[model samples]
Target: MSLPKELEVLQNFFVKQPNPLLGVETIQVLLFREILDFTVLRTEDTRELNTVITPLSTENDENVQRVAFLGSKQKAVESRQMERLLRTAANEADYPIEECYLKDYLCLECPRCALYGGTNASASKTTNANIKHRVAYSTAFSLAAFEQIQQTTTFNGISDLTVQTGQTLNERISVKPATIFPSIVTLHSVTWKELILMMKIILSSHKYGAESRIGGDVRNTVVGITGGWEEFITPLEFTMELNSEKEKSLSAENVTKILNKYKLLLANQKKSVILSPEQVDDMLKFISGFEIDKKFLTKAYEDVRAYRDVQENSKAKKK
Candidate 1:
């Protein structure tokens, strides 16, 4: 089915970062659908699957595994995880942070640390000062069907029993590919450029949840922008209602209709612009040319190196 123009607009619009100068309040919600079966969230206690098809309930069951579930108050994606991913992406892009560490100091020279957070204090006997993260993530809910399976281990190429190991089975569970989960991220007082960088990291996320060995591709992303509205129907709520009405019969037309509904709701209240595909590409191109402060990084690296040398020399003198 063809995509609704409104939904298409939203999809297109999300590719670029919002303008910080406009001083408009905006929230971008992304739905990361799994493209492969993965075992990320698991229960603490091993239990057999029940007849009903639903998320494994952990309440009152101390033995149940602590898995990330939909509609749960617990965050599905934490800010720390986002920070780590961004750091990895930055390093891969050749924007490595030069200062690894100093005497109880964090390498704040890096973009990830600057955008996420960092600390300079060392651990004390009681506690340590920690840098607070800037981004906030919502709990993610599973939208696709799940299945339970038995995990196993086997050995081969041995003739004698003494020389061979016995086969064993393990307990495991998996969510099917195409399963969708809705997650929201709220940014506070960040520049448009920084937000764009964060978006790039998110869009580049390939695997998340538990097992990276098993693929868990982020298949599709749809971002919704809102201003002055602190509360709007969450993507989870909207998707749930749509799923109920569609009875799991997802189609292009139905999806488009849902997006249009949301778009209409936003348009009625405030001005909005959903980036087109071309616009998003243009933004990416612009970001490529953006330059970072090399002088700041150089100074940070030298300071960290000097501090390390002093610490090492003091230890040597004591010895």
Candidate 2:
């Protein structure tokens, strides 16, 4: 029914209903995800998401492609992350869960559709045509350069039945353990329950990038939440700012300080309220225990029906 006192400052950002336009409030979440095992993040061409760039510091003598995480990869994983919980919520609310995909058939009538967005081009139907993504994601690069973070290993495919190695060993290039990715995700026009759902996903998601089922164990650590009309701190900025500190010796406390650098600014106007890591931890714990109630899912489903009805009426009038 309400947010905890620690997260109360973000109450104003939560909208009573979802609106593509005129939803000015934004909640930017800061994260420092560390790779526990390894991940294979690639570019559109399927090659490793690494490109050569000038040396970030004196560590590198020449320019070389640095492996970086891409925004699309993050969005895909996050979008997929909501599937199970969304279906459960729909079942609890007594609504049919219409399956949706990344770029395939979009039902355009689910909470997942509302948050991640989708497009329906069913030539005959035009109701609720397009849904804009409420959650925004940006790419984050490893704090360590690609060379320093990458590891190559060969593994033989052994047959379970025969217990024999395959004809050839396969090579895998992945981000090594302890590699950190500083990322920020922005949520727009979301309700309190939606916000809680998002936080839960962030806390629970442990894998990212390719071969997620097998490897790619990245641990997500949300340092804080900044609420306002606009209070976004980019991953590039985080990487840059943290790079200097990293040159010496970077610690969790240093990262937290970097996250709060912009908080003190524009305080008079209430543009944003940045949470400290301690405060963030407290809020995370509070939301972890909360569940997505049936009432919230019901309202979301009702909105979908209302939108479809309105669109149908408009199309009828035109015809």
TM-score of 2: 0.82
- Please report the candidate that would top lDDT against the real structure: 2
Could you tally the backbone clashes for each prediction? 12, 4
The parts of candidate 1 lying over 4 Å away from their true place are: 1-24, 43-109, 118-132, 145-165, 214-220, 223-231, 246-268, 271-319
Writing each residue's lDDT as its tens digit, candidate 2 over 1-319 gives 4455756767788876665553668888878788998788876555455544634543434444556788778878777777777776677867666666556566777667778877766332334657778899887877777878888878888999999888767777788889888788889878776787788887778878877887889888886687887755777767666666343435556656765665555433456666666777788888887666776677666665655566566668898
Model 1: how large is the Cα RMSD against the reference? Answer: 11.1
RMSD of each: 11.1, 3.9
Write one digit per residue (lDDT tens) for candidate 1, span 1-319: 2222323433322213212122334445444444455434443355332112332321222222212443222232333444564455556556565443323445544444444555655322212223344445654555433332222223245548687655544544545455666555555434344454556555545655445475444554543433223324454444453445333434434444454556666633554443443544555455444433344334433433443355456557788
By summed lDDT, the worst window of 10 consecutive residues in model 1 runs over 58-67
Residue 30, model 1, lDDT: 43
| Candidate-wise lDDT, in order | 0.43, 0.72
